[model samples]
Target: MDTVIAYLPSILRGTWITIAVALCSILLAVLLGLLGAWGKLAVSKVANIFADAYTTLIRGVPDLVLMLLLFYGGQQLLNDLGDYTGLWGYIEINHFTAGVFTIGFIYGAYMTETFRGAYLAIPSGQIEAGVACGMSPGLVFGRIIWPQLVRYALPSFGNNWLVLLKTTALVSVLGLHELVWESFTAGRSTRQLFSFFFVTLLIYLVLTAISDVGLRWLDRKYSVGVRRA
Candidate 1:
């Protein structure tokens, strides 16, 4: 409709923020996931217990609650630290940082499980073979375990990513200027509720579609040498 067209720029800007949030969050998630997976598999009982507690606590809590807690808790903690150092008054956390870290911290637990399963799926023989060839642990991981784990993890990773993309909508609750926030603002301003929401829905659909295609391409690329004839 004409109203939707008029709001295109606003919608696009919000979409950009949403994408940025998702990208940053996913990057954090992947890094944390890797570390968490390593911790879970570490030799030390302390490391294992810490990792287990993190995964269990994150998985058990509702994501929205976690997001709220992290945002408020982070703000308060920073403010307290600033006060201690006589830096200034309250140090506020912006919505973008809040949203990204919230999603990343929440999903990283799931990603940890995915990565762990993928690693376990790899046969012990491959690692042994690498060791027999006098490869260092790092080289063995790089040359053998890494590639296979990626291939196996792609499907689950893709699923998690798609879910993560959708979860970006929740960032609106924190007043982030993402798509849902923009749509709400536009709808309220214009009183064209259906039109703005419809546009928002379309944007989400497009994002999801693009992600699906990208994941598929990655899957193919990663599986190149191993695909059966």
Candidate 2:
């Protein structure tokens, strides 16, 4: 208990980093998800092919492999470009950026599928009705399609988010000072491996609990006026 109290500040700081990484990754995931969904649904063969290749390639790769490949590969690529431009000594790829982008890019593939399925679940008639009522395509999507997509997508979106949060732990391998990395350091320094790891477990549980509550609220908010008999 005393040791845990002593480490509270460290843990909190690390937890903040974890949260920031998750938020940034989620933002990227959402943007990529929308674009990927649009690409998958587009009539152009090139767009469809690109979307299919992205989802398939990303989904097939292991997360850790992808993370390492992205981080190291990106660094090397940047360094090579820097060398060509005579700025090799000045170029650096920060670990936080590497972690956030890697996780976001990997999970965005899954999110694309979730969004596409949700969009498909929406009835075409509703969109048509909106069109008949003199709603522009953009307005119809804004007022009708997007709302239902949110409601229908919430469950899968929440699932993907939970997984993404957990995956942030993997970024510790890249030496990011997130909770898991802190826990590892504390355990090694104090020789109280179980105690430190147990603390980390509790922290993760708390994060997941908060995420669940927030996602549920979002789900209900989006489901407004939806009736069940």
Candidate 3:
């Protein structure tokens, strides 16, 4: 107990880092998801082909392998580019940046499917009606499609977020010193592995609980005025 309390500050810092990584990754995932969904839905065959390949490739790869590749391979790519171009020198990718981007890129594929499904769930007639009523394409989507997309996507989005939160633990492999790494270090020093890991478990539960509440509120807000059969 004394040792655990002594390590509290370190654990807290790691917790904050974990949160930061997860938040940044999710934001990136959402953005990429939107763009990927658009690409899949685009009229251009090239856009559709590229988006399909992206989602398939990302979804098929293991997360840890992807992280390692991006971290090591990306740095190599940068060095190769710089060496060939003679425009700059070595640029090492930081752990935080690599962690955020790898997770985001991996989950972006899942988010693509989530958003795509949500978009399809909306009634096509409503969109046609909105267009017929002289709404611009942007306005029609903004007014009609976006709300229902949220309502439909919220469940899966929340699920993906919870998974993403857990996935942040994988970033510790990059030496980011996030929650799991911190706890492991403390546990190793104090021989209190169970205690530190237990604390880590509770912290995760708290995060997921908070996420559930927020998702519930969003679901209710977006379902407003819609009839549930």
Best model per lDDT = 3
Q: On a 0 to 1 TM-score scale, where does candidate 2 land against the true structure?
A: 0.95
lDDT of each prediction vs. the true structure? 0.92, 0.92, 0.94
Between which residue pairs do clashes occur in model 3?
A: none
Estimate, for each residue in 49-91, the C-alpha lDDT of model 2 and write its tens digit: 9999999999999999999999998889888888889865756
Each model's TM-score? 0.95, 0.95, 0.97
Number of clashing pairs per prediction, in order: 0, 0, 0
For model 2, what is the C-alpha lDDT against the true structure? 0.92
Displacement of residue 21 (Cα, Å) in model 2 is 0.6
Maximum-TM-score candidate: 3
Instruction: Rank all candidate structures by their lDDT, best first, as comma-separated numbers.
Output: 3, 1, 2
Clashing pairs in 1: none
lDDT by residue for model 1 (16-59), tens? 99999999999999998998999998899998998899999999
Candidate 3 backbone clash number: 0
Against the correct fold, how does model 1 do in TM-score?
0.95
lDDT of 3 at 102: 96
